[model samples]
Target: MKRITVAVLLLMSFTTRYGGQQTPSRPTVLEHVTVINAGSAPMSDMTILITGSRIVAVDRADATTIPTGAQIIDGRGKFVIPGLMDMHHHLLNGSFPPRPGGIQANLGRLLAVGVTTVFDPSIGRQDFARLKAAAAPDSSAYARFFGTGPMFTVKGDTFADADSPMPETPAQAEAAVNDLKALGVDAIKIQRDDLSWAIKGSGTLMPLEVLAAVVKQAHTQGLKVYAHAPLLKLAKEALSVGVDGLMHGIVDEPVDAEFLGLMKKNGAVYVPTLALFEDVADVAAFARRQAVNWDRAKLQPPAIYAPFADAAGARQIESFLNNSAFTKERLKVARANVKRVFDAGVPVVLGTDTGFFGVFLGVATQIELELLVEAGLTPAEALRAATINAARMIGKERDLGTIEAGKFADLVILDADPLADIRNVVRIYKVIKGGVQYEPVDPATPR
Candidate 1:
């Protein structure tokens, strides 16, 4: 994929912020909406007051008056929740074997699905550097994109290739981290497994000594480090090495007391990214059996994804769908382990690994929330994973997670109650990002 210069991308991103209109920092009120904030029960007939981009008040409609001259929105019978976050997102144009697309359009598609914040765990440094430079400060036009500028992997690791900085020693690991920090990345992501382990059944895993050194260097720089560990042993190694988060579920087997202890000691956040395994299996199985009766929902493709739709990306999805059985057992193990880990008191964060070929952006977030519930978490718990828990994972808990006074007014208005059914989250009626109303893209349209 060709890269769009920062200037061009920023211009396109700016236009999307206010829907080609001037963005206002004025007052607004959402009246009589059913509020669900901070993992609590629904509070109906509430009026949430917003001034500029911060929520000023969340009061009962009968108790407080709407500010004069403020734009008033009737939110009757609508369920209001914090704007969703995807802790494990990606940009196909920025990953290995780059796909064609502009970043701005993809960001818009993410917003269209009510995702106000996104964290890409593994992104190429050059791509992240360009995006960081292009995005405007205090811009509300697109969902937030934070990431680790490329992933740290060993020479023989799955993602190793030209441009990949494969560290071979502990000294190299620390140096690699320092290089990433210099690029102004938000966090550090380390790859622990090789890609071929799933298909060809042969791959080299990153050594523990090197990972520990990487984690130490990252923490010294005040950056949280996340590890891409898909198996139980590798997950334990990452946790024991003091990684701040695990990017995938601990599959291959159930967790044990020692694993729980390691997680507790390190306070590592678990981001199952269940959709990665699940989608791979589902698509692959369907394609293998040539099933056609399934509902093939259409997703609107942002202009940036056009190149992907036409080239190797399209072929990759077909190839993956034809190999669904490869991930079937792995996904089952992940589902079981997620439940056990959550039951053991580990914090679970929501991440969909969207933008990986078939993984749709905004739509995947809602699906992930439902999957969380299916893995033995209550709806409230699952909501928190995407909200406050997600915010916590990225160390932005005070600024952008939940819908609370003095926090950024990023919220989603649902046509039905999500507490009654998690699927209601996809019934997006309206989206408010940084206190500005955003028109959402219909998820039904195929991209």
Candidate 2:
């Protein structure tokens, strides 16, 4: 596939900003529509001049603001926001080799809903390479995908597992770290020792020592470590070693001020992949919805996901959740949990942990954001978690998460102001990825 050179595709008419520094000047002549300046001290009516892909100039939306020799776009009643981002999302289906068109669907849905950037914290190294290739500017089919493969895990450990295809030894772990570095794995993921062995006694699993060594060695190789910690002893150990980030919310045991202070000192980022739990809930709900008079449906198969669905699955699972929820009142617990964590100042980033669970990438992300708000974030704060703050988490602060010039041209145009109502973010009008414009879908069109 042909790649678009930044020299060629990047702004010349109007300065552009996508994961870059210094907002470029808007075009003296305009094309698309009004420009929206986000992250400003006071966001008001600001018009951006667009000459092709570059934004040349920015000025108030007054009659005199229109430049001569510029093609005017109707900006009367629309809003333009910097493209949205998802810090922790699985690549499409999240399995090795992934699935055909799965990444494409995820990206499309993301762009459709104004998500222009995603950081896939967990991915197969092999799969990561494929996704990275597909995300190249020229032939890419989705929003930008930044990924990290298997965590440093030992053979058959139980908390988390490695998925580099072949088993890894201490020596092999060092080589694995080297291989991932050579292949440009974005960051190293670590979880309370790789525990796949306990799950099935798979001999291929790496031991906790090996996993820790992997993290230690990967750090030497200049890779950041992200862990699926649950405040377990191993998690504390991982933290004590100074991981760069912690994956998953502080489940199992609630994090205290002491833990938060430690994390703060370590400069570790926390990605609460809360939607994973909701995914299980959603699946049960989906199943229950499917069983409603499945035999009477008119489709050729009668009902789409019925035969394979366990009719009693929902009730069975609900019984367990009911007990759990009733015990702690899950929502109340989660809310209190978030308040505790946030009040302690643990750096938070948005993540949905899609692909493995029933949660689809793009769809589940929005749900995560909604839940984040429910967990005590103002919509703007939640937006920052998905955008600017997330970028900071991956150490990509100067690159893509926010809107500024010289940044990657990843962006989303929304019809509504998300800061006002996060849910309105779904009302996306257009998406721009690396300077390529993706026109919005007309809902009236048949799927």
Candidate 3:
């Protein structure tokens, strides 16, 4: 594996100019690479020309002309794919009292694992501002961040934050959407499901009329609404009311034809965070059979596992294990729903609900891809879920997603073809964000 050592040069070009005149810097080119463009056939032996932050050209290596002073990365035997997107991520600030240094560490880990973009479905106004600042394009590292600032839900909902709007009427819901629009949120997130399965108490469901108002106002404001509806009934209600996407799989029951029809009618996307449900079951299974071993833990990476390696972690695992039956059933139903959704031609975007209990940040995205494959999507289809489909969900398909000319040069180079095996996505050779190449993080180090 060849490592590209041009970070210093790339950083310098961002600010440096020759003779007091801003001259175009030499383009960086990836030559003779197998491009696995999401939603399209793979193109072999292609040359990708990148200038500044955009891919300027993608052509056959033999037919393309390299610039006079281009920085060429020999991409022989390597596979390049568009950077992965996590549509339903939650930043560290969402944690109770928030974790110190969590934002920087999480961002680094996410980018290290080829996740160049992430959409946080729930964040407070101040936290969203902070995240936006940290993820600015000028920063050398960090995933491109978009978020819904403060979800809309009823009071006493399990997922509700202090700032979350507990709208009682249609006007209040509209006001909440206006407030989020003022906060510059990329979308609206509505929590409508009772989370009693995870939490002890029976959670409150948001009123359908208020939910409808929120969706309508968000759409009127040119923003999409992504509803957190884990049950079949809630999902149907959200779809009927015009929510643009479901933030989780329908876990209560298998989705029927009517639900699929509503999804198609509303042009909605399904984000089955399968890795989340699987993580719960995995933790339960691990607790039932063996003691905690950080290295051997299936879900938690070392850095995430470190904090919960003691007695507390054991208790947490025990609690989940006690509810193993529910978690396992949810995982089963979620997987089935994903396959049905994909087979029905509805767009299925990849998300892992990262930042939740037991879900590691960077590695969780890869797990989601694998789970997508396990749910009956081909490796290529899974790639599309994480790439082009995610972009479409976020309304950034034009600038992000697919490897093509005039798109952001956010890409991942793999030593092995992910099309052959989805796990090969972890065999990252290099990650390029905004045309700047970054070396993958060493797993031996703490995240």
lDDT of 1: 0.71
Write the number of the candidate with greater lDDT, choosing between 1 and 3.
3
Local distance difference test values of all predictions, in order: 0.71, 0.56, 0.76
lDDT (C-alpha) at residue 89 in model 3? 88
Residue-by-residue lDDT tens digits, candidate 2, 1-447: 222112212222212222121222332322334444334442345554443343434445543345444434455455666666777777554222234455644554455556667877767667788767766553243666787776555444432445742335667767877888888988877656322211222223335666667778888998888876643455666777677777776644567666777788888877776666443444545333323322222111322233225556544444433433322324344445666766677777888776653445455666677778878887777777787777777677675665555555555666677767877666656565554455544211111
The best candidate in terms of lDDT: 3
- Residues 266-361, model 3: lDDT tens digits: 899999988667755665342222223223322233444543335666465646445545767677788998999999999999998877755655
TM-score of candidate 2 to 2 decimals = 0.75
Q: TM-scores of all models?
A: 0.86, 0.75, 0.87
Query: For model 1, how many clashes?
Result: 10
lDDT tens readout by residue for model 1, 86-189:
99988442222345666655665565668888888877777787666544344446677788988887766645666566777889988888888888899998
Give me the displacement of residue 194 in model 2, in angstroms. Answer: 8.2
Task: Write down the RMSD of all candidates, one decimal each.
Answer: 7.8, 7.9, 5.7
